[model samples]
Target chain A: MTVNAIQTRRTDPYSPPAEHLELQGDEPVAFLDWRDGRKAWAITKHADVRTMLSDVRFSSDRSYPDHPAHGGYVPGAHKGAIIAIDPPEHSAIRSRVMNEFTVKKISLMRPRIEEIVAEALDAMLDGKSEAELVKELSLPVPAMAIAELLGVPYEDHEFFEHNTAIFADSSHTDPSQRVEAIGKLRDYISKLVDARMDARGNDILSRQLDAGLDAEEAVGLGFLLLIAGHETTANMISLSIMTLLDKPDLLQQLRDDPSLIPGAVEELLRYFTIAEVGGLRLATTDLEIGGKRIHAGDAVYGLTNTANRDPEVFPDPHTIDFKRGARNHMAFGFGPHQCLGQNLARLELVVVLEQVIQRVPTLRLLDPISAIAFKEWGPNYGISELRVAW
Target chain B: MSAHIVAKRETCIGAGQCVFADPDAFDQDDDGWVVVLQADPASPDAIARAKEAVNVCPSRSISVLTRPEPGAGTGEAG
Candidate 1:
């Protein structure tokens, strides 16, 4: 099909588009994105997405002026962030903060994570019958965990959280305002990084400082960990709860067998696959992926949401089957640029879900599913607010 | 059965699946690169876990070589 003939699939935050699901058997489709008006290739199949992500020839360096960005966001200008850079620079920067997310290290934080979850749940229970899960439990748990990790004072969470929400909300279209929000975050993190240099704490920022990263590098690392550390996990938590409430059978299964919580979490992650835009890369050399030849400097967007639901790899991909091995899903992404904090995200989800099912036995959505506000466009896909009550 | 584990550090991407799956056999260094703790594991559980680690490795940098049984002949070598 010609690029002009390919329709831009309308995406729902909760479900993969029917158009994308139907186009699974076809070659990777190309389209001019309505938002940016840039022509790019959309990788739909699971095998193709994985291959595109792993291939070194497809560069993640978006800092270059020619790199393709969605909706006029120039990633190349935002230097020092690990996601926007390719290796060996990416590997070097990633290694400095990698130890903080190891299973053993994150497992040590389980007690504190559980405490945060309990406090949030307690506030929700004590307040009102109709509680907003996003604000109550979903946002606070990860916010607090990441705050503690970055050694940022918990009292100032509101400032950082609000700023992060602005950039994360795809509907918030004021470019100038987004730039201002980023500026505020950078200044806030810069101060924190400076303070940690004088008085090093046990948090990730202090660790980065102790490891000999300059002030600027430390700020970039801290900025990435602070924004990414909480926002993605918080959204995943909110989305997971909504999915469980929608499917009472799945919720009941978790309630019946608490051991199924981890498996259920994996399945939920795969089914939702929140990073709707997938990983973005500009080809460093001419490459052929899925029978399509991409020339040098071409931009390729991996549609991970579509890939996760590709029937070739996942039999009956539309259905959420907890029994299936879904850990390999690209929800956390694949290849060298896979999520740095996946272990922490997984631990937080497992703890929060298990506690909610065990403690809040009667928890159910207070609002109709149709009324829920889902984010229409953004790097991440999740609900804006999820109202739940027991 | 005993198994030999080798971690190709050059190819390791620090996904840490090996350490997650079989901590006894594999551990990460300060930089988060894989560090093989036990090349020859004695326990059957560790051996099984090592196999899982090999399967889940994103970079395919891990390898497990199992030794033949005590009385088993090496027909191929002969």
Candidate 2:
């Protein structure tokens, strides 16, 4: 319940792969003991996650402090807006970024996205026979693209990564660091907004200005966009690479026919479900699920990865099928906040996939799949190192 | 022919999901929040879209009230 526990945490909140799947079985909802000494239920099925998302009783409002992952949800931390808020308040903050995050709006950057991936790879593979994909390529694309979209200095990529890491790490491990990250992230966006307003380049930030959004809202949206924009995709980049390494046949299949990349990526996303945990919420009132009593103020987790792999929902859950219906898995999540950045993330993956497959025809793992390390906590679950050799 | 596209101020947190749904029909107002319009929309198709925006709102904030003229195709939604 105290900040001290998270600091010395050992394993993640959820169980490991096989047991994680078993724990998620048939049970529509189950509560986990919170690190902060509270009760929180997990929403494992796709239907349940969707239903809970729209349920007014479950607040998306940030101030709750009762649910895990919300700033205050963790002991020794405060709260942020949007992702942490409920109702029109959350809606207000989300709206500020909607224009930029809109499918059409993000789609406009297709060429820019392509260019970013191409250049990032070039730099990563410059003179090395072996390269760490996540550090060199996977992370930078989203970081750069989000930074550019928000009109932040490209040089600030390292800073954005650091702050986001701090913010996310705070949620999982250290509550105090979370505050520091939030402040830094907020400050960076504020300064960037002021700078972009004066320069008013034809970027996402300037468009918000043209649309008459105020400085705070605009900056707020930028913060959300920058974070929401990259985090998952970055994890996907590393995790997907790691997943491919675990199965060489699939990697070869992708290599032979690059056109299959998009569908393959979706399957990978659906199958991987790198977002180990879903957004947390407490029931505003009593709710019954899976023959279990869920009282009001009880916490619930929408375990998207588990839901995506449920045997009933997806036949042969363990096996990854290229032709199977790998989509409809709650990877992008479900309902209202069902990943506003889905299109952008998909586009990034598509472009990244196309570029990687075409550029490195012989790309293979420099290290064994088992050796790759994963992050201890946060939404995007991924490995620490993914070394590829050509 | 003029249909007022009003947002229940309480329901609207202004995430611009509606604005993206129908950019031509909506805009942000003076307060940097969503500006719900009461004017006649650009076309019947545009008005129909204003209704879809209703569903996309995270909060039940937006409702498109149609003020139909005589013989306007209100019966057959665009």
* Residue A73's lDDT in candidate 2: 30
- Can you give the lDDT of residue B45 in candidate 1? 82
**Number of the predicted model whose lDDT against the real structure is largest:** 1
Model 2 residue A99 lDDT score? 51
lDDT of 1 at A236: 91
Report lDDT (CA) for all predictions: 0.76, 0.66
List TM-score (chain A only) for every prediction.
Answer: 0.91, 0.84
lDDT of 2: 0.66
lDDT of 1 by residue, A52-165 (tens): 888867887766656654333432144467777887888777777777777678888999989989988898899567788877887778777877788778788788667766
Would you estimate the TM-scores of all the predictions? Answer: 0.87, 0.74
Residue ranges of candidate 1 with Cα displaced over 4 Å: A2-14, A28-38, A70-79, A161-181, B1-5, B22-24, B38-55, B63-78
